[model samples]
Target: MTAPGGNMPRREALPAEPNPHAQQLAEQLRALKDHGELSMRQLAARTGYSQKSWERYLGGSSLPPRAAVAALARIRGADPVRLLALHEVAAGTWNNSRTSTPAPAPSPSPAEAPESAASPESAASPESAASPESAESDVLVASGTSAAGAGIGPAAGRSLRIALGAGAVALVLAVSSTVLLALRLDAHEDGPAVASPVPAAVTTSAPAPVYTCRIQRVDGLWYAGISRTPDAEVAYGSTGPGVAEAQCLLRRAGISPGGIDGMFGPLTQRAVKALQKRSGLVPDGMVGPLTWKALRG
Candidate 1:
């Protein structure tokens, strides 16, 4: 059921991207934030942090404190392990941003370079240079010698090794990040967690607001026009607009999401699995980018 004239107030965009490393951490936090459907005020009230601080953390402007992350995990019923891992990795960038790097040793001046290089050659007597066949070069020259005996200089060799090492580390991080994200999503897709407890600060007397799934087209994608977050991970414990959006997409695909009450329960999980199985996805009950793309498509 498409709502042709569906409208939702546009939300303010987040600040410009933060450091590359920090951005990944921020994105995960944003997805969790969507899961709870909490406002900045609500998050601040719960975590005892200022709303501005949350804006910085969620916008990737700064690294969040460990305690703050833990508090949010508790509130959202997240496992906290993955979030903490991401935070630990992102902290490298945070710490580096504050620390100053030392400059490299200066290269010898051009005038001094020639003299310094020539002194070694000048030191060798002509008698040693006139070595006939007594030098060890006879074997090397016959079997493996080339005129290219001069290898990279010490400075150049060190730089090359450092660059290669950095590239390898970066590749490892990229792979690890992908696997961890998949594992986290897969881990969350189960029977809903037994919520431990809601802190008094963030607790409210009012009932959770129900969202209507106003399905519509935008940029050639189907959106609920409620949260308008296409990539947020929606799992068993998730709620709010993300849930409503999934429900609408499930229904659009001709599977009932048990009527879209904005809570993620057994029926919605089944609907998600049905869609994944039909679409040839892995059929993990959680809805991440791939599942969301299938839904929108």
Candidate 2:
């Protein structure tokens, strides 16, 4: 269901005509990608721009960055001057649209607001101070007094205190007896000894996946079979085959991605950043389309 002139399927309709400049810019970019015979996903891979971003830019949902416009132009083998110029005009229009709308008037500050001549309830009397009456905050004192609003008097308070103290003693004795009984039972148990908890933590983790780089050409792109995804976005703390694939390719590129462990740890991220720097890409420590291309090579 792709558009006739573009590979993007049934392209989204542009926003209203208020941003004609932006809309025109998006149309032109869409044409460029179409002429290049590349889908938005492929464009992302070749241009280092995200597919969703291209969708927004081409759909006129928002203005694309200057770099994004230039990148698409490079991918399409077109000069970026015209697109950049159009982008400048669209950027101006976008900014104007945002600023032209009237904002709600701000409320006056307390100092600037009209003041009443007198406020009857502004000053509270000392008698208005109320004690908390919630049962959670209430504590019955042994000194012949209960919390305010709690109906218990001196004699009742003493009786309650005695009952609570007795309950506490009973609980302590129950816990002690249980512990003693357990110790005695454990001492008498006759069978194979229970396993120690010391090795539990060590055994909890499964082994990490291993990868071997079998670099080979596949349709003008190199793949190592770890993952064929050339545009899967990965960053620090990412995991799975994508991370492992990045590691395998990184190893082939002579940059260690730390044991090809599936986990994308700090060491793997540092290695990715290093690889990105060497490849003349932004050293973002993230694996994007461009970084994947570099690794595939």
Cα miss at 184, model 2 (Å)? 4.3
Q: What is the C-alpha RMSD of each candidate to the true structure, in Å?
A: 33.1, 35.0
Candidate 1 on 1-297: residue-level lDDT in tens?
111222111233445653566777777777787777777767766665555557767776666765567678889999989887878777666555533342232334789668634765424544323322112223323222222234544444334433443444456447857997999887787434434345543675677677777789888888877767768998997888788888988898899989777889999999999999999999889999899999998
Q: What is the C-alpha lDDT of each candidate?
A: 0.67, 0.68
Window of ten residues with lowest summed lDDT in model 1: 1-10
Instruction: Give the lDDT of residue 167 in candidate 2.
Output: 50
Give the alpha carbon lDDT tens digit for every residue of 110-138 in model 2: 76333311323212322112211111112
> Which segments of candidate 2 are over 4 A away from where they belong?
1-205
Query: Candidate 1's C-alpha lDDT?
Result: 0.67
Among all windows of 10 consecutive residues in model 2, the one with the lowest summed lDDT is: 128-137
